[model samples]
Target: MYAAGLLNYSEHPMKVIIDTDAGVDDAVALFLALAAHKDPKCPFEIIGITCVLGNTGVDNVCRNVFTVLDSTGVSNIPVFRGADTPLVQPFIRGESPFFGVDGFGGVHSLPNIPVVKQERTLEKESAPLALVRLAREFQGELTVVALGPCTNLGIAINIDPNFVKNVKELYIMGGNSHGVGNIRPCVEFNFFVDPESAFVVLSAAWNQKIVMVPLETCKLAMSSMEWRKQVLGTIKSSCSISLKKGLLQRFEKDYGSWCSCDAVCMAVLLKPSIISKSSTNYCTVELQGAHTRGQVVVDHPQKTGKPHNVTIIEQIQLAELERMLLSTFHPSTFI
Candidate 1:
């Protein structure tokens, strides 16, 4: 029955809005989203791409978004520049040594595509506002896929108490289960980079569905040299070409193969059944603590008595995940 349930969820695709920092894996996630949008079998439509500051500065992230869209030949999907810094912490300006200087390893030049301007007169709202507006417009019909710090989404929830209720589901790529951390012994990069924003977003009262791609499981899904060769070797799109020659080359030289955080996030969006052993827990971010700051403090023992806001994904079937990842790049096999 468990195996059958996973198979069932993999068959349906959901509507998604990807909020990212445009890191190397974020680029791969964007490619996956674009691929799903183009596939007739998968009915996922990328409503928009919002840039945030995590892997790089906000300006560079915005530029990277445009570059990826241009390379993928997708101009209709709007890209919005989000918050430049965290709500409480000082803006830490650091480039991702792992992802290369220009985020996408300078594989493809920054596209000359024109930035999308907002026509609505609400003081030309930021990315968070755009997200709130879209949530209201497509209430209960959209899924929020967050691949970076939760600054924008948290701001949106603060703007309206019922802000997140409009969305059907929320998929977040942060937090660490099993008491392990990627950035530190207790914190992951995404949540640690902006703990205040993460706290606000996770504390919201909306009862909508939530799926968290914890670092515990995501770390296990790392990309191998063989997988990169398979994706770059088989796909023939313009995006794939640049990803193969440029991004993959730098990735192999630097990090061996990309970590699968963003890719697993995209896969979860496409097929939720890839998840197993999810538990409802009350999670909050620790802004204090010198070494443990930005850590996701999960109340598994009901210490807080607060309602569970996060569904922590604990296990994933490796065989099925591998199959899905391979199938995503194969043109003959859709969904």
Candidate 2:
């Protein structure tokens, strides 16, 4: 049974900006965002998408972002390519053998949507400058859904210490509280890949809201064959077909469950009450550990007596998740 509290945010949707790396999971998250945008009850509007480097190269991620948008028949969402690598470090290629050469599991066939060149003027602006401009323009109304390394966000905060105060909140898909890491035994991929950026963002003094979806919570929200079939069944456009085929093939090959880690993050932004959250006394990123570099060190026991900097999601209701997904897939049946 779904918890009553989990269904709380159905009354209103939030304005959001998705910063992603365009992984398969990221694609799922994007779909959830689009679905929310389509819902009349949900007032969420995806202002734009900012691409980063993590699951794949910046170019591949940019392509995947546009491809996913095209497949969903969504246009007019401007995408900006952020930093090509982490702040102050060279780009180290990850083991894509797990996620396919291209982040979307090597889905070759794509929609015939014209490859719209990125708005060069937007590209010319530094990521920090662009973020500041956007925040100022949408002051106190934009929520940033960060689904990858926090490089651009950190830079933005550094550029303008008041940057966080100007926005609504930041929904981040990263960190691991239980010591289980996807990239390393103790380090989650997103934090490990760019500890510096993560540190800067997390430590910033932001009155803006913060919701963190850790690995522990995300692992429990795994995808199954039934879910994949449901998602594929909803495809009526050629772009959707290409994405569905590629996604299915990847899952069949034993790559990974099309887990919606990023999607869950987006879901929380749309409906914050869907998951149970806990307040950590304080949290810091481990950057120099021998085997635990990039691990999110939460002060669970309040040993430091420091003020809380982030709101960590410790548990989520599965029934509520299923309900949300079903409603997103079939909007008319939701009411």
Candidate 3:
């Protein structure tokens, strides 16, 4: 079900700026956002996309974004190039093997690809500067959807401390919980790649209306391969043949189910009701520890005097999310 107040904002779709590192999951999130933008029922308008370093380098991110934009026929949404590495750490590369050689699950080389790149010159802007500018322009209205390392956001906050206070909210796809990890034994990939930046961004202020989608929640909320097959199989009329083919290939390679870590965060923003359970907590990233570095620590007030800074989504309404995903990615969908 859609959020109660979504329709009320139809006259002015909620303006959003997506900050991502453009990996396979990030690519799916981008496409989901594009699909949502086309839905009159979902109040979201992607104002711009900013790239940072996480899954791949900034250069590859830019190229991948351009390729998606061309394929989806989404025009005029400017994409900015941001930080190439974490704030205080050396650039970490070659970590995620699931995304394969291209960080896109190796689908770019598939035979008879229907999505063609549009011939156009690309101009770029600094990601942090773009963040600052867009925040000022849409003060109290802009919502930032962060899908990668927090470098770009931390830099923006450093440049302008009020950047966080000025924005509407931040929907972030990172961190881990329940003692699970994708990179190290205790850290998610995004936070592990740039823990310093995550620390800076997460601990910047006492209260900032941030919603975190961690690894454990993603693992349990929507991990059914049968559900994926049912949804993808029935959506042939809604998705382009190329995208459908690509997604099927991705599912096949993964042995059916895909967790959708990043895309699920995007889904929450469009329909807040997708979350069946959650908690507000004082959250911060661990900067030091031989085995626990990059782990996001959520402490209770009794343990720490600090107030809660984030709303940790511990669970989600999976069936509702599946419905939302189906509607958002249907091929007839246009942005």
Candidate 4:
């Protein structure tokens, strides 16, 4: 079921750029991406990271990125700031943030974490422009892992139609596959924040491959409460320490399970072999409806007669997902 064209043994190192909102789960996923690169033979070679507004403001997002960099002892990757608002409307969070106002699980903005101004790691160029430039520069070999709203990428495509045309793959952790919603009824948080951008990005005519790890799949990837407290809580690295202290603040205990949605999506992408089921569908975001404004309108069963545009991960191995996430914290634990 893992036949969505991402595997290539000859292509040892896959070039990647992460677009995120720096949520707690995003932090976990970001660290996972960073730590995987520590392995000299790992397939992912992250080119850069782009920040957007989702879990918190873009400024806080930048600060959180720097915090992750500080924890990981990584400095080479450049970070870029992107759209603060959506394409057609402002992003109304509509509720209090689950990952705290700063999206670091309310470490209460621990003083040890370096501010963006202190490290000055953010690039002068904006994220949308950087995205377009990178896609053109990479010339069809760049994989974009978007862990937030599709605003930045949508803006990039609008700036240059060929931006999507030049990209190799896009892995997004957003939307609901079966009308199951997290933030609102029939809507997921990311797509709900920016439905217009979601509509644009998902509906656009693109030659590049798009793989979505939906909220549904992420739910299936959740770890049991025992596993979270015993296995994940026991790891003692900078990343793991951060995870226990701040990253899992509010989300650590939810329905007797730990659901790191973005990290689940990252694990699926990092180890595609864990994908036990997948489907090809023409998916689009609902732009207008009283109750279903941001719902992902996946055309199931060829009802639309449209060519399948995106590959949606339907099922995954929960045990394998745990292994990948555990390795992200303690690199040598798995192998």
Clashes of 3: 3
By lDDT, the better pick of 1 and 4 is 4
lDDT of each: 0.71, 0.72, 0.75, 0.80
The segments of candidate 2 whose C-alpha lies over 4 angstroms from its true place after superposition are 1-9, 95-97, 108-126, 226-258, 327-335
Candidate 2 at 146: error in angstroms?
0.3
How well does each candidate superpose onto the true structure, as a TM-score? 0.83, 0.84, 0.87, 0.90
Q: Write the per-residue lDDT of candidate 4 for residues 1-335, one digit (tens) a residue.
A: 22112222223458899999997879888877876665555666888999999999999998888877767777788999998899998876646688878877655234443323235557999999999999999987888999999999999989999988888888999998999898887799999999999888887777754899998888888787778878777776555535654445455455457878888788777877778999989898888898999999988877999888899998898887776666667734222
Candidate 2 lDDT by residue in tens digits, 1-335: 22212333556556678888887778767866776665555667888788888888777888888776665556666778787788866657756544566787777454553333333323555555777778888888888889988888988887888788888788899988778797788788888778889988888877643678998888787666666566634534333423455456645555355456787887777777777765654788887888987899888888888788888887776656766655444423212
The Cα error of candidate 4 at residue 37, in Å, is 1.7
CA lDDT, candidate 4, residue 60: 90
lDDT of 3 by residue, 1-335 (tens): 23222322224458999999887778767877877675556667899999898778888777777777776777778889899878886964665455655566555533443565567444566999999989989998998999999999989999998888778888899997555787787889888888888898888762365899998888766556666667544554312332434555555664456667887887777767678888888888889888888999878534997777888888887776666566555655543
Among all candidates shown, the one with the greatest lDDT: 4
Worst lDDT 10-window in candidate 2: 113-122
TM-score of 1: 0.83
Residue 158 displacement (Å), model 3: 1.3
- Kindly indicate the candidate among 3 and 4 with the higher lDDT: 4
